[model samples]
Target: MLDDYGLIRVAEREAAYRYAVVAPQCPADLMWPDIRQSTLSILDAVIKKHAIDKGRVFLTGFSMGGNGVWDLAAKTNGIFAAAAPIAGWYNKDEAVHLTSIPIWAFHCEEDDVVPITETESMVQALTDHKGSPRFTRYQGFGHQHSVMYETYSNPALYTWFERNRIDS
Candidate 1:
């Protein structure tokens, strides 16, 4: 999935940043504890072993990982410089807590599985809380198509990621 983000190309083309992809060993439904813990563990290891710039760390995920992105970012508290969740659903009740984090969400209007309203309501809650999160909805696409179409070649998303920093 990290390949979809052009991360390898980005790393090869530039020397200023490093990227790592963590795949949790669990099914999607069991993602809450198992996958979340795995991701956090990988993140902890990365920070400890590498000369990483904490302020520039970013989080991104698609599908189940997308859902994990929202949950993890809120729980971690000022850890990620920015988060981008693709085709993921977030709990609307937790929206306000994400106000300080920069979020860029992507989804499809015709996604039958997750439904577009999942992301819509979360984005609305964020807006209601005076948070500005960038969102993109592919008008005629479905869940898988939207992610597959946008993931690899979106130059703007990468540029946006570069502009954010957590300062923690």
Candidate 2:
């Protein structure tokens, strides 16, 4: 499930880690649901076939796919250990259900497509429920620029994923 501008490929294979990228087909209104379903199916297969640490499974996405990350995390419940949704939106009603996972969300203060308020509202909803989610806002960047450059340039995002694991 690759979203517009999303490229999912095998990034690395090593003794201790495997990295797979998932990019969703965008124009979000038309493709999001399909992307979600396919992604969930793939996740199920990955869980069955691989010796996934389960505790370390991470989901990260930008733009429309970022929205997918939020949706998947909320819908799948305990399946993902952590999530990073960059410049995305999640319904406040649905977002309240995300109780157990750690989320590190990113957004640009200047974003116009998906307003920063959406992220703020989500954080507020999560906090209202006593959930902990780390949020970062890039001051001058817009929505697209914030996610694209930040994700590629910073190695810390990957490290963040590696640091957490699902609680069994």
Candidate 3:
């Protein structure tokens, strides 16, 4: 998975979605942090380089990358319009500080790698603070299924993302 080979397949599909998949020349263990920093850097560069609407910027990920989405979005505060963390996990305490932005979480009930409890606990913490987040759990799906693929394939997900804009 550390190899960027699979991303080529995603790029080939295109599917009307624009993505900037970054691959840092680092060890596998460092990829997560690299992705986090690079994503922010890319967004900063894009905002400065083009006529960015600002309100339309979004962050999303799957599995380990899903955890990255939560971490990055939470850290950025008002920078991202919305976040969709698929089968991700994060510290519940950190989640409280993320009430400013909307989050849509996806998880598979049969997920064994991260456990569905992780997402449920995070969602509970977020909702307990009156945070508005949408969560959908695939009944029989397992951890291996690609949540991002499922998310992108569903038109409703794109529509939902398009509806929300960052309110600063």
Candidate 4:
């Protein structure tokens, strides 16, 4: 992600840096192997075509996508540098699969659509598994998409992702 360079292509220390935000929204479900594989294929294609940095690859999502983030992180643990799932939900048992990777999860305490408990349970489970995951619990958002506005606007989040990049 490199934290919204405004453009996907930019120059950093005279070296050209390229990044892409590929959102696979089809089927709106991340559990489907076809969709997950297809998304991976798409990323692979983009990386090979554009020479994207493998170590900087990050995963994120909102709502259902947030839930997908947890699932995908578990299934593709070593593949992503880090993950930021907003208002996502997943089975607590799956926490074991995600213990090794860095995660930053967000959720509104007042969320009516997907209760904050969903995120809490996951975060708690991850911690129980000895995984130190970051959690940002906001109040008054109440499941509204405004949570995204507040989150994406923060520069620190992007920098956090950069710091967590995998070393190749």
Candidate 5:
């Protein structure tokens, strides 16, 4: 779910952490399986190649990639150390599965393509299920506001990822 940024944002964090960026060729509705497969394959490869801390495996994405983060994080348990989905959406059915995972979601108030309510609803569903997830909402931003630019521009997001880990 690389969306359109290619390797721009993900590459910036490479100096601090090992990560794999996935570029999805499929359309949005049919992207789930490919995203899941690519992510799992990357995880397997990273574990085998690097003598790294398994608990520190983090996930983040922009736009459609962000949506994939929410979907995958909900589908799998204890696979990611933490998740940060920028302008991502999810269905209520995926709420319960995300209870144990630490999530930090971001969205803009004026995004016309995907309404801010998408992220809000997911957060609200998780909250109703007694799951607390950190959510950041921008006041005056649209679809092109926060995903790649702000998330990368701010160090706090990276620090948030570093602070969280899956309960192993």
Candidate 6:
């Protein structure tokens, strides 16, 4: 699925490793904790098995996965160096937890599956909390796979990742 989704290409171009965790199928009310644990476990497994630069770890995802990026980075404390949540949304109250993390959010103005306002509200919440998050809003694209393709393919995202990290 990662190859089909072009994550392999993203990893190769960034010279970074990307791990995708598959969560057990469940309803939304019961999903967040499991997803959070799965993400942390993957991080632990990768750090244990590879030469990972602990400080440069970043999180990104599209659609539902993008929602996961937002939730995980906000709740997981210092684990992620930065987060890029594409076409995703989260509780605006949780924005307080994200104030310290670097975020680069993306959404399409004509998104059909997930409304662009979801991302707009998040970015706004972050801003209200005095967080400086970069946002990329595209035109003529609905909330489809092409958005992720364009986002992951852009070299600027990787360069931005390089510029942000958890200060040890």
Question: Which one wins on TM-score?
Answer: 6
Q: Model 5, 1-168: lDDT tens per residue?
A: 344353455465457644554344436457765668776776678776875567877777777878888888888877788888888787877889988888888888888888889999999999999998999988776888455587766778778877887555
Q: TM-score for each prediction?
A: 0.83, 0.80, 0.80, 0.85, 0.83, 0.87
Candidate 1 lDDT tens digits, 1-168: 444343454555655544654444347457655566677788788877886788888887777667887898878887889999878887899987889999998888888888878888888999999999999888776877446446535878778988999765
Residue pairs clashing, model 4: none
* lDDT winner: 6
Error of 6 at 165 (Å): 1.7
lDDT of 1 at 132: 96
Span of 10 residues, lowest total lDDT, candidate 6: 17-26
Question: What's the CA RMSD for each of the models?
Answer: 3.0, 3.5, 3.3, 4.9, 3.1, 3.0
What global local distance difference test value does model 3 have? 0.74
Tens-digit lDDT string for candidate 4 (23-51): 66647333544477787888899889888
Return whichever of 1 and 6 wins on TM-score: 6
**How well is each residue in 34-138 modelled by candidate 3, as lDDT tens digits?**
666776786788777776778888777777777777788777777888888888899888877878888989888888798988889889989998898899988
Compose the digit string of candidate 2's lDDT tens values, residues 39-138: 7777777766876666777888777777888888888877788898888898978767786888988888899799999889998899889899999888
Q: What's the distance in Å from true for residue 104, model 1?
A: 0.7
RMSD in angstroms, candidate 2? 3.5
| Steric overlap count per candidate | 0, 9, 0, 0, 0, 0
- Candidates sorted by TM-score, descending order? 6, 4, 1, 5, 3, 2
Clash-forming residue pairs, model 2: 2-23, 2-24, 2-25, 3-23, 3-24, 3-25, 4-26, 55-165, 55-166
TM-score for candidate 3:
0.80
Candidate 4 regions exceeding 4 Å error are: 1-18, 28-34
TM-score winner, 4 or 6? 6
Alpha-carbon local distance difference test for all models: 0.76, 0.74, 0.74, 0.79, 0.76, 0.81
Segments of candidate 1 deviating more than 4 angstroms:
1-18, 23-26
RMSD of 1: 3.0
